[model samples]
Target chain A: TQLLEQSPQFLSIQEGENLTVYCNSSSVFSSLQWYRQEPGEGPVLLVTVVTGGEVKKLKRLTFQFGDARKDSSLHITAAQPGDTGLYLCAGVSLGNQGGKLIFGQGTELSVKP
Target chain B: IAGITQAPTSQILAAGRRMTLRCTQDMRHNAMYWYRQDLGLGLRLIHYSNTAGTTGKGEVPDGYSVSRANTDDFPLTLASAVPSQTSVYFCASKASAGYSYNEQFFGPGTRLTVL
Candidate 1:
């Protein structure tokens, strides 16, 4: 089975602080996606990176796919209270597995204003 | 339009009781999915249906069942609820337009507590 492990499971930081969350795995994936979930709500898609070494930016957030497609990262610049939530990384394996997405445990960010 | 909606926003049930979570989408998506989220365990897929009348088991499908009778609804049933099955359940849908990647629209989620 393929598994994606995320680092710094919990993070608490003051507003304006920058942070990075990493997702690593031994298996390679064809695509990786980042999602943000607020309390009591379902996750919302942030971005999708399909190529190795690909980088995508959305407002204050930046996402990067590793050179080997086995890992990915999300960097938040000047995080604010609005950025506090659960960040999840999900990957689609080489075959896509009928559109299945394997998810990481997730990194919970608490940004105090 | 309401992209997706789930019934019984939250539910409390006793062990061994049967429960069904209803999901409906307005986008007429071709694929629908059911996922359960637990503390420290992100979201695990319980079941999925690529199209109407076709369903398949997902990573954690042992205690659950799903049916996709039409293009817009996919309901999940728990024959005998267990304490371990208590978790936040989410319903998602994708257009599956043959693209390598697509965004999945998710519902607000249903909070289920089994005791």
Candidate 2:
């Protein structure tokens, strides 16, 4: 089974601070996706990185995929209170049944005003 | 647009009881999935259906069963409920026209507690 491990299981920071979350795996994936989930709600897709060494930016958030396709990272610049939530990383492998995703434990971010 | 709707927003049941979680999507997405979220575990897939009339097991398929009779409804059944099965269940659907990069939209989720 392919497993994705996220570092810094929990993080608390003040608004305007910068933080980065890391997701690492030993198995290579065809694509990796990042999601943000709030309490009482399912995850919402934030971004998907498909190519090795690819980088995608969405306003203050930036995502990068490892050159080996075995890891990914999410960096939030000048994070705000609205960015506080659970961030998850999921990997899609080739020939996966129905394109099943292997997810990381997640990083719980708490931003204080 | 009511992307997805899950029945019985929350349910509490006794151990050894049988329960089914109903999920439906109106987007006509070809792929539907069932996942359970627990503290510290994030989310784990229980079952998935690429299309109607087909079902496949996911990372944590034990104690769970699913069926896809048509394009919109996919229900997950638990033959015997256990405390270990208590968690938030989420139903998601995605259009398959795109490659592996398709986005998945999720429902509000169902919170189930087994006593």
Candidate 3:
């Protein structure tokens, strides 16, 4: 069973449009991370949020950790074709000491030029 | 420096055959993990090692096995390959706890097919 759930599994929009993806879980987490994966390549970490109610920004991408530590969201502004890829969210359980990370299904995004 | 490397970028194996996927990291990370990615299941952990000489099972560890002999290498072996074992496998490593906030460096990946 999947511990985390992601919304809008597949998304497609024209360039310059903005989009947001959500990741939710019933369990609390110590840290949550967002990764962008290109075709045939491993996932690359985009951002990591540790504290609840924290917001981080990387260029035009904004990431927010829910105040309850049970959810997170990723927002990309002025989406470009280069932003097209698979977005994944992973969370570290509070009880995880060995660094086990639980992952969500993933959101495949496509930005049309 | 090469963060991580995986062998046999892609392979085709027959059922009941034994195969092993190799992963090595030069970062000397204390933790290593093996994950498999499928269509809708995303990435599922198979096994992990917190440090050399220690290994533990992850969410999905049925037909797979792993061993960490040293700080640099972790190999995952499939004693009996099955069609269900077909998937893209990834190897990842991270700095010890308290040093890194769950950011994992992943290898390119290995695509395996069991017939």
In Å, candidate 2's interface RMSD is 1.9
Tens digit of lDDT per residue, candidate 1, span A39-106? 98889999999999999999999999999999999999999999999999999888765668889999
Q: Could you give candidate 3's per-residue lDDT for residues A1-113 as a string of tens digits?
A: 43989988999999999999999999999899999999999999999999999999999999999999999999999999999999999998887777688999999999999
Candidate 2 per-residue lDDT, tens place, B1-115, comes to 5699998899999999999999999999999999999889988999988989988888899999999999999999999999999999999999872357889889999999999
Q: What are the per-residue Cα lDDT tens digits for candidate 2 across A65-99? A: 99999999999999899999999999898666456
Q: Which ten residues in a row have the lowest lDDT in candidate 1 chain A?
A: A92-101
Query: All models: lDDT?
Result: 0.93, 0.92, 0.93
Assess the local accuracy of residue B45 in candidate 1 as a C-alpha lDDT between 0 and 100: 93
DockQ of each: 0.65, 0.67, 0.67
Q: Record all residue pairs in model 1 with backbone atoms less than 3 Å apart, i.e. clashing.
A: none
Candidate 1, residues B50-112, lDDT tens digits: the string is 889999988999999998889999999999999999999999998982444788889999999
Candidate 2: C-alpha RMSD after superposition:
1.2
If ranked by DockQ, best first, what sequence of candidates would result?
A: 3, 2, 1
Per-residue lDDT of B41 in model 3: 80
TM-score of candidate 3 against the unseen true structure:
0.97
- Relative to the true structure, candidate 2 reaches a TM of 0.97
Least well predicted 10-residue stretch by lDDT in candidate 2 chain B: B95-104
